[model samples]
Target: MTDPTLGELTVGVEGLALLRLLHADDRGAAQVARAARMAETREVLERLGREPSLRGPLGVELGLREGYARWAATYDGPLRLFSIEEPPVRRRLEAWPVGEVLDAACGTGRHAVRLAGRGHTVIGVDQSAEMLERARAKVPGGRFVEGGLTDLPLPDAAVDAALCALALVHLPDVAPAVAELARVVRPGGRILISDVHPFLVQLGWQAQFPVGDGRAFVRLHRHRVTDYAAAALAAGLVVSGVEEPALTPEAARTPTTELVPEATETAYAGLPGVVIWEFARP
Candidate 1:
């Protein structure tokens, strides 16, 4: 019952037992170590814009929320994706007129703290209370509320601006969440939504986390650029700007294989790492 992802890693004979142990729901050191290695390797693959295997727990016991419940504990730690995404989000925020802010799917207050620190009245919303607890601690002034993207617990046209960062990938479709985002922001207010680039998600990169001893992969939808545009159009949110920010100039052009394999570096070097949408309610 080894995780299907291990087939890609081929972690060697010593890792077979580890994989089996993880498959059996045993979170022992061997399993944990192997899972961590796999996750790191997957991250490297994802960075190179290759599709990483997304296999993990598969059943009701392994719901996305449950996995995040475990992932919430370390949601704000040092990870490549965080570093890759945070800067672009910050840069995008600079162009917007900020006031009351909504941090939809605000995990661990990572971006919320920064936005709040910039003097925006930030309200962080997430499904995981465990994640919200850390968010609350990170930005005491920012309101932390437990909610999902599909049904946000907020008044209509309530906020001046909104942000849904790297979260729409979890949804089966972007429309529901986009509608919610549109519903909350006042007319003329801006909404900045960032996500794993459609190209990367189409390449099979998954939303996952190393939780407890085993790994947890939340189900994700592969959304294209058109899907986002359609959702916004249908919701009546006017598109103001679309940004496809790449990795830092040095890293994107370096052609280095220190982290990723040579083939992947060749394939994806200098490519856009994330997709950002700036929309306004008219």
Candidate 2:
């Protein structure tokens, strides 16, 4: 497969800007912004036509195994989404009665460690063995298993609650995983899920992180709001609440910001950065 080009990425960013500007509130200022974006896109296209290096490979794209393995060493380091996703999720998780909690796709036991500290018996399950190793060390008393979300390595109705964080976007279809999460929780139990919002995905969000001297990105699937609703209904889980956290200025910075800071900021401003869902088994 051909790696995406730097020029292509820049053009994509410009395209995103144009898309947002064109569809946003039809005010005179919006029209001005939309026209400016079109002009910027044309200039970028002209430069791409003349520059050969810009058309070359951007960076390495890795599969989940290789990507997360390389990421495990630094995965616990400062992460932007963690700040946006964790607070609301932790509040809901903490409110639940202390009991067995399944942290599905629980990379490096970020949530598991905290839940364990709060006297909850946390069981963290992740696909990456490397991540699980870190999770084991962090929460020695908590159980850590190498498992996938769709086919969890646990018995049915084994946990009182479940939390799947920033992992569902990796799956092409979220239904199976939703059903699996439901299967593992007892009736009347709750499940909380957090992920990069579909709007961000449409604007080119992915599972990206540092690897060695460079960077690697794992492709993310676009799951619309309806998709989550259907999955929950099919799994017999009731949607209690949904939260869409808007992007903060700090979290909106991107690699392309250097090339077009205004476009980058404008593209992401006021957009939802993450989506957190609360579900109850009925």
Candidate 3:
């Protein structure tokens, strides 16, 4: 399939913005906003006519290995998801007794370093060797292994606790990975998981990152609340707690927001950015 053009993206944004404004109780104000959105759409069409090159591809889609390798260099930069996901995950991780903790899909050792610092023996596993290299370098004392989340490198009941953060969304089916986590943790040991909420995925969010002048994205899958609950139960894990932290306006903003700030912000406002799940083996 051909990558969507910039003009196509702009038109879609304008349509969404107008749809968001059409429901205002103040009909007069809504009419004015709709007119502005229409004008913006018209301007994009005119520009595309004048410069046909404006219809060039906006981004390229990449596989997980290639995407993470390209992203590893700038992975430590200010990512909004990390900011929102870290606080809650950290709170729960800190609450656990400091024992061996498995950081599955532990890109760049973001959580492994902290677990190591807190005196827990950290075992970090990830599919991307480039990311694992960064993780190894960042947390020299922690054990970093190159491995997939569905087939962990450790034995059954190997760790006291496990954390799989912001990674489950990448999997098309989360059941195998969930079962793997359940298998690795000892009985009564806890597991913590954080992922992009399925709501956002339904709203067309993908794992996007910058690549030179254009953008690149890795497609994400939607794993609903029930999907997770069913998988955990089937794996003999009980849900201890769940948290759906709403996105801050800043964290919710997307590149398209620049064109329709109010409409875009309104669509995402008060929406949960990530879902955190805490499970325990009985």
Alpha carbon lDDT at 87, candidate 1? 77
Clash pairs detected, candidate 3: none
RMSD of each: 11.5, 2.3, 2.4
Which parts of model 1 are misplaced by more than 4 Å? 1-3, 9-61, 212-214, 247-260
User: What number of clashing residue pairs does each candidate have, in the order they appear?
Assistant: 0, 0, 0
List, residue by residue over 47-67, the lDDT tens digit for candidate 1: 434433333322222566776
Report the Cα lDDT for candidate 2: 0.86
lDDT of every predicted structure (CA atoms) = 0.72, 0.86, 0.86
Residue-wise C-alpha lDDT for candidate 3, range 1-282, written one tens digit per residue: 777776676677677668777887899998998888788778877888876656776668899999999999888885667778889889988889889999999998888998998999999999999999999998888888889989999999999999999999999999999999999999989999999999889867788889998788888997797888888999999999999999777787776667557656655766789999999988
- Candidate 3, residue 232: Cα displacement in angstroms equals 0.9
